[model samples]
Target: MSKIVARGAGVVSGMIGGAIAGAVFKQVWKLVAGTDEAPQATSDEYGWGEVLVAAAVQGAIFGVVKAALDRSTSRSVHRAIGG
Candidate 1:
């Protein structure tokens, strides 16, 4: 029962973290690229450097957010379960 609840909480945390990461990525992209729209890797308008950097930043933000949320959820679950 506790494990099930933890799993559900982890899912919820991931969803929320993803949404937050999207917003953060957009803001970062605008600042880094000086554009509101992010560039696609295959797009000709941007060079490979720009596209790769954007991808790396976005991925890093998402990974960080997910990790933080997962950690917090795990701690909460541990406390709730008195473990």
Candidate 2:
């Protein structure tokens, strides 16, 4: 039962985490690039360096956010399960 609860929580938390990460990345990109939109890899307007940098930053933000959310959810589930 605890395992099932954890799995369901993981799925829901992951979706929420992704949304949070994307919003965070957008704000960070705006600060770094002074623009509201990040560059697409196929966009000709942005150079390879710019596109790669954006991708790297976005990836880092998503990774961190996911890890944080996963840990938080795990801890909450553990406590609720009386562990």
Candidate 3:
């Protein structure tokens, strides 16, 4: 059924999308902070601005990835169902 396919594809695509976003965030963070290790808010070494910026970047990347994957998976499911 198309509904089942959509659900399964959504779940799988969501997981993969998260992974993609995390990888993208890591690369972007390294570029922005010049280090692979992300800053923690609780750490005094990293200021509030740095921590907030990292969070914002991660959230943005995740949102973008989710949206893209959702659209792609929906189309794939429809095609699979011959709709």
Candidate 4:
């Protein structure tokens, strides 16, 4: 359905945006902290637990942001249509 496709596209865009933002923030943190790498456990150094936790947090944040934006856009469209 069109709604499903739209939602999927939104999620993909959110994920891409989140990833780029996360990477930029990580780099900035490194620069500020004078570190060469992220403080979190690297893939090769740690088990899946850390990675999964980080991912879940990121996903939740991304979902919340995406939902807020979607709701705002929908309201704007309804207002435009005098609904």
Angstrom error at residue 30, model 1 = 1.2
lDDT of model 4, residue 13: 61
Predict model 1's lDDT versus the native: 0.92
Between candidates 3 and 4, the one scoring higher on lDDT is 3
Instruction: At residue 33, give the lDDT of candidate 1.
Output: 74
Per-residue lDDT value at 36 in model 3: 86
**Candidate 3: deviation at residue 2, Å?**
1.9
lDDT of 4 by residue, 1-83 (tens): 54565566567666766676566556655665565554455567746875565556556656666676667655655565545
User: Which 10 consecutive positions of candidate 1 have the poorest summed lDDT?
Assistant: 30-39
In terms of lDDT, the poorest run of 10 residues in model 4 is: 32-41
- Quick one: best lDDT, which candidate? 2
Q: What does candidate 1's lDDT look like per residue over 1-83, in tens digits?
A: 99899999999999999999999999988887789988799899989988888889999999999999999999999998966
Give the CA lDDT, 0 to 100, for residue 58 in model 4: 52
Instruction: Please tell me which predicted candidate would have the highest TM-score against the true structure.
Output: 2
A best-first ranking of the candidates according to their TM-score comes to: 2, 1, 3, 4
TM-score for model 1? 0.91
Candidate ranking under lDDT, highest first, comes to 2, 1, 3, 4
Worst 10 residues of 3 by lDDT: 74-83
TM-scores for all candidates: the values are 0.91, 0.95, 0.90, 0.50
